[model samples]
Target chain A: MISRLKEKGAGDLLKCIQCGSCTSSCIVNAVNEYFNPRRIIGSIVKFNRLPDQDPWLCSSCSICVERCPQRVNPLSVIMALRMIKYENGDAPPSRVFELIEQIKKTGLAFPLSNEAYEKRRSLGLPELEMDEESLKEVKKILSEAGF
Target chain B: MSMTLYLGCLIRTLYPEVEKAVYEVLGRIGVVFEEPKGASCCAPLGLFSLSKNAWLRLNERNMRLFQSTVLTVCDDCFASLSDAFKILSEKNNVRVPEVKPFGKFMLEKLEEKGLRFSFKGLRCAVQHSCHLLRPARNVDNAENPMVVKNVLEKLGYIPVSYVSELDCCGGLVFEEKMRDAIARRKAEALEKSGADCVVTTCSHCMRQLKSVSRLPVLHLAQLSALSMGANPEEIGISEILLRRMVNP
Candidate 1:
């Protein structure tokens, strides 16, 4: 019931009837039991504490959302839950954290460490460039946005 | 115009051939690139895993470093960049990084920073990245998607309709148990659809679909490069079938 949850399109949690149709149709649960959409909804309906790690199991595939007769976007609910977990520092994996750190340091993700760039250049590909001045402009825009 | 090419993890490690093809194609289209040092994982994996704050902060740092228009040949990177821009702009109230779902981000970014570039239209099938189209809800139509098709048509490619246009390729769930079934379903849809070629934004989907389909799956950049007259072997899709349609 967090205000941000409302902003993220999670207003339909009340409309869910617990019929298990979403559970049956969810591909995530078909492979991984931890990804039960019904259980997550049950917790929300009962006002019980939402499980900390359960929401992270979602791949954001939207299969459940497509199948739900009630129009309840279970993925959005999971996303809202994840936001709470993120703020509380209960994140899922270290690789996720490492990746974010890399992006923060380098403009692109997946460090070009594998020498893929050189291989590309050997194929007669041109070297890409964005000088410091342009980067400064982008930073200026992001800074203005409170980033 | 010269720009930095951003190749994500999957392309670098799993599909270096794709990287090669994209480079050749872009070069043919008169697009030049400089690969920056130390770029790594756009953190879409983290975002997919629901690490929002981590995803946000990391992408924020990327936004800070990039001053030039960013050009990416990978749909995963493109989707991640677009989604990150949307998320950060929403939270921080700043300008959304002018990025196209395909090759537009780098071009638009250049324009924003006072550079000039012209785009010739491309004929292709736009494989929408799941995160951008499904999660971010940035795509206009969920059932019958058109963002990528519209972009290509505007750029000059005859956008062809395909059956797997809106189907999932099981990219995110590749590690899951149902991956084969999921991939099969996506492959069937794409094969049944009659696109001249399958052009996608996500590298993961490209890889997944490529594994299952006989039809050629080209990255949007490769298609652009091909249309601009890059040789097929140089584009790395010469061996792939170019049949008009897959048997249903």
Candidate 2:
């Protein structure tokens, strides 16, 4: 499991001293106690599985990444774990899938609604339509990348 | 060198007001910038969890659209594109354009022009979003980020210090209630700061704070445009505050 995590670009997972700085500084953990980075790291290192907490709750804000004294990069470890789980068919939160679907459909994570389109026009902004060819290229890249 | 404005998904779609501000302010300052012919999402954080290779590849593809420096309005877009290009350039020796956050880019331009507006004394609470100030080595004084404060001060506003100045808005958290809790906490701190409004560089932070905070949330560009004499209707901000800002 450690080797898989390392291969997934979280090679510093073993350097974690369980100092709990990640938990203390975590924005998600500050609000919701369920998504604890320190406990998740300990569980992954010890039991070779994620804890019962939802790992998808991580916001990728990188505060934990910056604050880790051991340079363990808990954020990268969480991302690596998420990638592994996703590849193994662990369903992420529905919102993530919706975001992916939106990007796949429009080449944009936040697509403009009809009202927003009109608002742009009223505001004297240029049309934001992604050209057909570029959209095709974006779709092709995502498909090639296994999305 | 000229810059290409990279309006990533968040600013281009969810917040067209930010786009207008960027456009007007850059034009007013006489900075030469144009929108790219083809662009998409910066392949934001969610994609990294799905596949790192895909994220890097999409960013590299997007990077090809701009020939020179790329000025990004969204902090996530700045971090994602720059970090991806750092790795891609190391491995492939590819030529990559410089990726700059809007605040830093504006600071440089204002410094070069030796420009300073009259102090309006409008108190602003600044949210220096995480991606723009983190990973330590990438930014100086990451712990006590002054970019937003400096930009606001140069644009003639008083940056009111707040207890939760460094707190994340939790825009990245997928859980609705948890996200609101974090944002509400930050909003409460900003509210207690006695500031007239909240100012931020990231569109996600603006969205999150605007949703939860009673204080009017302004993008740095929006504030810049307003202070530099743009009408409220032109920049899409409230006219009353605009009147106080422009005439002051």
Per-residue accuracy of model 2 over B96-160 as CA lDDT, tens digit each: 88888888888888889998988887888888888898876355368888877888889899998
User: Model 2, A16-130: lDDT tens per residue?
Assistant: 8999999998878887788899998899887887666776788787888888889999888888888888888898778776777777788889879777787788888898778
Off by over 4 Å in 1: A1-39, A47-57, A62-73, A80-121, A124-147, B1-5, B20-40, B47-51, B90-93, B103-126, B135-140, B150-164, B194-197, B239-248
TM-scores of chain A in all candidate models:
0.77, 0.90
- Candidate 1's TM-score reads 0.65
Provide the lowest-lDDT 10-residue window in model 1 chain A.
Answer: A138-147
DockQ of each: 0.20, 0.76
Tell me the tens digit of each residue's lDDT in model 1 across A1-147.
Answer: 545565644648878888887678665665556668888887877675665345655656675776677888787788778666666768454655554444344433345544656666666644433456544543443344333
